[model samples]
Target: MDLDVFVTAHRAEWDRLEQLLGRGRRLTGAEADELVALYQRASTHLSLIQSSTPDAVLTGRLTQLVARARATVTGTRRAGWRDAARFFTSAFPAAVYLSRRWWIPTAVLSTLLGVLIGWWVAMNPEVQASIAAPEELRAMTEPGGGYEAYYSSHPAASFAAQVWTNNAQAAAVCLVAGAFLGLPVLWILFLNMANLGVGLGLMASAGRLDVFLGLILPHGLLELTAVFVAAGTGLRLGWTVIDPGPRTRRAALAEQGRAALGMAVGLAAVLFVSGLIEGFVTPSGLPTWARIAIGVAAEAVFLAYVYVLGGRAARAGEVGDVEAADRTASLPTAA
Candidate 1:
């Protein structure tokens, strides 16, 4: 193929495509159709040039032109603050609300297990001794000891940031690792509960159970709720692998995986708030009742957000996934 001849033949079409692209949303139906046609023709021309003559300069121009035309023909959906707002109000809450069945039971069972473990440790000296030496236990549970000092050990802002990062990472891992059939999520929950149990047991043995509650409840309520949501969503993802219901296995996994990822972003925000409570409110000099009330109020508001905004969005068909327009078109499957 003669390079000049090929360029001359397709140059008018390429110019038209560029003109349409420059119009940017001002194209009529005819121009839009023409742009797509010209784009296809230019693509063919570029292929021929590359495979035959292999002219670097001509190939470069066509490459950029085809890219711009493709962008114009396909259009882009850039996310802005509006998308963020919709996610928090609709997608995030709807996901949490939908997965409540899994997480609620998880929360109850885990709490019971923690309490049981605490009781065993408090009542049995062997259990306590097995956990830690007697002197270490006393230092942890005694007044103004390690357990209470843990909160005030760092600056509030830095502590909150650190807590948020750690919790967010945990939630993300739960959501992602759920693909491995949820075993990891359960183990993470068990470790969390076991740690809590150890704390409760030590404090109770020292008659400082009330102090533990005072320190923990302010942030633990919301913190644990976020973890449970993540764990439940992850368990649901794993179960989807086992039983995809009406959808194909791939389709079901894709849908749930997308929702789980979105839930991660939302859960990060929830954890941030809990971190603030833990860092500032938990360590503050306020009365225990006031601190607990703040935590309770935050948790209540979150639940209402899920039940109200999330329910409304779910009823309207939001499923915590990306907008329909943004999703890849799935191949049709036979029933």
Candidate 2:
């Protein structure tokens, strides 16, 4: 086809696509997702065409339509925020239920209980030396006492580096493990529980419980809980993928992933705060009560942010309840 004719033809087709997308604005749930995807594809094609021709004319009608499409996308996103707000408003009862629900509690308690059983396995004398021994202690501990040797050779900077690196690795693990979604999340929670139990056991055995408390209580609870939240999300996502219950795995996973990601995002922030506390504050020998106080204060802040403020977004109620209910009906169940 001739160049001008081809351009005109393509523009006309694009215009129709945009109109359909505009009509899609009134759609809800899965239809909405489909419309967004379609619009995305059209945008990509437009980009390709624009890139291929430096002097391409911007047809007045097409330009106006693109602007309208962009406005529509913006409106959709704003509406999404409103829907999330409505979710929290309506779901507060659900969150409270999850907090008090027997099944959710049972799942967590059972996981913790299993970790207590594995405490012995992880604390095997051999395992103890590898994980507990500071590798940097080779110089200070006279070839045997790694902890002494480790900190002596390196100033606190090394410890800071190690802590930061480990925390980052844990965060990444929390994220990547979610690929399995919830099962992997369960594994992470178990791993964290075991680590907590073993570390506490070792500290008690050495009678350095105060040192441990000063070091861990300041940040341990928040960090561990955050990790658990991330794991929970991943697990939920994976479970949706596996069972999907009534909905197809794709639909279930998308909804579960949204809720899970929201929770995980909050948890990631906790991870950083915990890292900072562990890195700078804990090692400084802050008083035990001080550590505990700081820990409690942090907990309060997190609670307020998540439950009090974050739950009640400004955009609440913009999304229709009927539509939200439809999405919820198809959405995978997760506490």
Candidate 3:
């Protein structure tokens, strides 16, 4: 009960503990044992002071020291291959499946918008004229023209890397901007769809719609799906900010933010596949059907992974957040 006596008694042990901790990783075996013993004694000292005294300053210092000591004693766990494997197999897919409500609608609406715009541009000569001069349009959509040449402009490796970087950047933007109510995400999607429509219209007007489809479908299927997933997750994050349901707005945003992050990482891998297709398959001598089939097969596998592995993970109560043991304790609130 006597604070001064207690401090004097334990001060040397606390100082020794600090000294051992400061030794970095070169502690001798005896010192290691001594450090553990000192840590336990300091913990007991902290508990006694907390129970018997009202000294905020002393309590805070002990609290910090105890935490540091505990960490030093337990050591940190480095992420290993197993962690990465578990994430891809369980965490990433669950996040994708959980956001299916958002991404699926995004895919459907974007497709419809692109189709309508393409049709409008294709059917109207005036619209085509507005897009480009006759000479320029011809230079682009004509056989062996700019549209076809674009994919082969660079070496396959460089082009694939470029596509991957650009797509990853776009996905990252969608995720980071989700905090802004997903306005940027919507704008990005609109711009992408409009560009597609313009391309479709220009090619169709030139009677090269088949060629355009041939080149695009081989990569665009998976590429556009990844974009949709990114945009959808971003929109969902924004909605969480607006309507947090039963949880506090902060809690809801935190949860959605984590899921969005997981999608960002997973989408990078997905985009890589599409990048390979765009760089290689789109420009290859293979038959159009074969190229399109490759893209379709890749997309089918991704969807199945989400529905099967991710669906099961989600049903088992995984929302792609940190494990419960790692999460901070939340204060109790009325339902």
Candidate 4:
């Protein structure tokens, strides 16, 4: 039953029963006995109802009651982005961080992508040249390629915007496309890694590794983490179907799916945020020290926030302060 309805239905009868027992008021035989029982039942460590004025106690109880009513009324609304963040701040790290070793696979995927992309672009020079730049500068592919010339000729603002936009799109694809079982996620991960590998490989083969890493690594760390997380989530989903353990596939899928989505969302935000930094900040090929500093600082902040804050709120047995429980118990149920 709904909380307010339950409270309303029970409060009047309870109040009448209390009146007969004379709690918070003068009492004689039965009322005194009942009041004594109420006190004994509610004498928790934080029993604010016993400690605070009746008015303060009643007010707090009524506020909670009204709040529950309001929540019931606003069924259309759910928590917002902040709520999502709060959840990620707690859940992601708890699930992933106890074993920081989990990140090794992600790093390996990223490195492999780098290598493959380099090879692919090398093999498909024409496609590389085309995607990297248009025909007017096709010759830029010849000597260390035209990537440098392209960035040099383009305005800083424009380059940043393009890079940011591209990363944003890639991250989105990484997130959505990785939702299937392990294979799909693995493919997507490889596809992205290869793409990056080739793109950078083209640059590196052309002798632009310094420029590429400088521009990409700062934001790439977070952006790539987000992508790997997406892939991992997919693996999680696939595992559910493949190994369901003792639970039925359906049940395991639901439980793991919720967690995977949570991971996906966390990664999505990381991508977007990192994309912003990439597009505007590092894309300029900012000083080496500054880029490293920013990257390290960003990772640290993310790690600290995620692992530290989640699920610390009142858990089942330990939720309310003793006072809250005591106060709640004392309130007339019907009101």
Q: What is the TM-score of each candidate against the true structure?
A: 0.80, 0.55, 0.80, 0.55
Per-residue CA lDDT of model 2 for 1-335, tens digit only, reads: 24466566566557555656657347668755655665554555444444344244653444455555555655643347775664555443233223323224534774566456445634565655655464432222232243223323445556656665676566556555665644555566666676566655555445554555555677776666555555544554565666777655555555555554444444444666776766666655567788778877886676665555444532353211224423322223243
lDDT of 4 by residue, 84-124 (tens): 55455455554444323444576685687677667777667
lDDT of 3 by residue, 1-335 (tens): 98988888888888888888877577888988998888777777776675466478887877677767777876767778987887899999999899899999999999999999999999999998898899999999988899999999999989999999999999989887888998999999999999999999899888899999999998899899999999989999988888888766766787788778878888999999999999988999999999999989989999999999999999999888866544423433346
Cα distance off (Å), candidate 2, residue 181: 5.4
lDDT of each: 0.89, 0.53, 0.86, 0.54
Model 3 Cα shift for residue 74 (angstroms): 6.7
In model 4, the Cα lDDT at residue 198 comes to 61
Clashes of 4: 14
Residue 194 lDDT (model 4) = 72
C-alpha lDDT of candidate 2 relative to the true structure: 0.53
Superposition-based RMSD of candidate 4 using all C-alpha atoms, in angstroms: 12.1
Reference-based lDDT, residue 217, model 1: 96
- TM-score leaderboard ranking: 1, 3, 4, 2
Candidate with more favorable, higher lDDT: 1 or 2: 1
Report the C-alpha displacement of residue 115, candidate 2, in angstroms.
7.2
lDDT of 3: 0.86
